[model samples]
Target: MKNIVIVGGGFAGLWAGLTAARELDLHGGAARITLVTKDEYLTVRPRLYEVFSEGLRAPLRPVLEPLGIQLQLGTVQDIDRQQRSVHLSVAGGESLALPYDRLIFTAGSEQRPLEIPGAAKFALNIDTFAAAQTFDRHLQDVLRAPDRPGRLTFIIVGGGFTGIELATEMRTRIRAHSDAATARKARIILIERGNVIGRHLGANPRPAIEAALREAQVEIYFGASVAQIERDAVRLTDDKHIDASTVVVTTGLRANPLVAQLGANTDDHGRVIVDEMLRVNGAHDIFAAGDAACAKADEQHAALMSCQHAIPMGKYAGYNAAHDVLGTPLRPYSQPNYVTCLDLGESGALFTVGWERKPEKSGAVGKQLKQTINTQWIYPPSGSRESILAAADLDGVWPPAV
Candidate 1:
């Protein structure tokens, strides 16, 4: 039987697997739909900062099992476009090469390594589930110990969305493990090279974001960045130094390096460039989505490396890939609406609509909405198969209007 394979178990891969399965079922086709990923569970990446919370993941089997989509455990080590096959390294130190009639690549991104001195040794990250848990464990270990001079200072490198959220959420976490006096004296500093926080979010939301950070007792060290992170001190670009026991880096995220193995058209960050149909720019039988894909959202816009873009892009890519076998025309991919909801901890949250990021909601109301989006909206559609299929439909509830 002809196989339609999707790699990665992120937002994109999960959506692609479901939509593709739905398409096959609709067409009453015999084509097999298989999802090969490093793990069977989908990591709730957007909530990694909320690692302190109980929910951080949902199993792919619950969703994918409803459909006939087969789950293969492995990482795609390579893709040979010419051979139309992929080299996979599954669990148990085993290896296998599988051929495919259609392929969807959604490997996703990783935190960029800081090139600055001493960064690799001292800086912790909250990018992945593993990383976030490790950071939490270390924090618990530190705060549980008797008062140490620098152990209470938490230095967060980068003032972007992730950095800000982590910093704010961390305040409560640090306080939980320390006494009232130590918690009051605990230092939470955010270092950024730019003059403002949430620079990518445009100028409109900065005021609210800044105010929120300030209210959280989070200090912003703008206009400069961390030159180096030592065991107990962070050196600044301006030759200044701050004593900090814990350092968290959230500065950069580049597309997954695995996409480079395809040798297709990729941007500077190593994300595969896809055509309007979300197909790989220079390769046949290949499609990509999520952070691994650099797809044009509109005439003048390109999809960012976010779940907002990934979910819709995955739907389109999977629909198109399925149509290739169904002998139907493929629809062009587009997502004109873009929104951002940044979590601000105790100060509530900020919600913005459109690319300009004009604030639609702020404070407690925004926090509630953000919680809903994070907890319920983005999760895999559960309940009936009909409900999940309806949600995955290209023209239905998904690719929601902004």
Candidate 2:
């Protein structure tokens, strides 16, 4: 029997493992599929900004075990491509090596923390389940402490997707922990180094985003950069100070550093460049997906580091890996359609379509759609192999047929 090893347990890793098992099962091939990761739970990363609770994580065993995919909890220390083995640092500082006939690299991305003065010490982020939970506890601490100036103010560093969602929802989160008057007194401020908001999202949805920000009463500091983060405020590069009790940084994300260990050419974000079949450009018997691989979605756009792209990339990469081991044909990966559904808290949400991001829905309708996606669509099917495999199909419709 051949060994198929997958790294990471997030959306990409989970789906990749499932898809690989499904492919092998369809062909009646006996292959041992194992998914290795640092944690036992699949963190719903997109919802980390919304609220921190146990609901944000789903145990992998309930999903992976029924599919015959062994779950190994550990940190992948290095990949020895020459030896066809992955070195891992498991619990109690023990080391183990797993030789693989085929390797799927799904090691996901991480928050790109800024290297400014006091940032490492004073700034907080909701980049992961643990981090979000820490921030949630900090919010409670804020409520317990005696009243002070700027006690409820939150400074969001960036105007991108995560920053925008967190800023707009800050007040609502506060209200959940305190009174309406306290929530009303809270200040949500967004600081962007760029001149305009949602700079990367293009101009098509700017109007809706701006209106949502205005409705949320989020103050925008356009073209302003934070020089340093203090215990209770952030100092701008221009020597100006914005006092806020809490500072949340949403700078952006970088691909897992393990991509470099494969000795493949990578993009600026440290994502390995892969071929059409999602194989690492210069490596053998190894494939990459999710944030680890910079795969092209189409001729015009490359796959973004989001759930929208990661899920499909996982399916394709998994299928191609199985096919390679089975000496069968591999399918080329391509996703032409793109969409963006941004949650905007009390002002509702914004849903757009295509690479240009043309507005398709907004306000209540968009919020409902966003809620469904965050609460239902993104989670993996559990406790049933049939249902899980069905969801792992290669030609599955994305964004659903609504």
Compare the candidates by lDDT and give the number of the best one.
2
TM-score of predicted model 1? 0.96
What digit string (tens of lDDT, one per residue) describes model 1 on residues 2-115? 889998999999999888888888888778888998887788888888746546878888888888788999888988888888899988889999889999998999999888
Per-candidate alpha-carbon RMSD to the true structure: 1.6, 1.0
Local error of candidate 2 at 246, Å?
A: 0.5
- Candidate 2, TM-score vs. the true structure? 0.98
Model 2 lDDT per residue over 67-116, tens place: 89999999999999888999999999999999999999999999998899
Q: What are the lDDT scores of the predictions, listed in order?
A: 0.86, 0.90
Candidate 2: clashing pairs of residues: none
lDDT of 1 at 266: 88
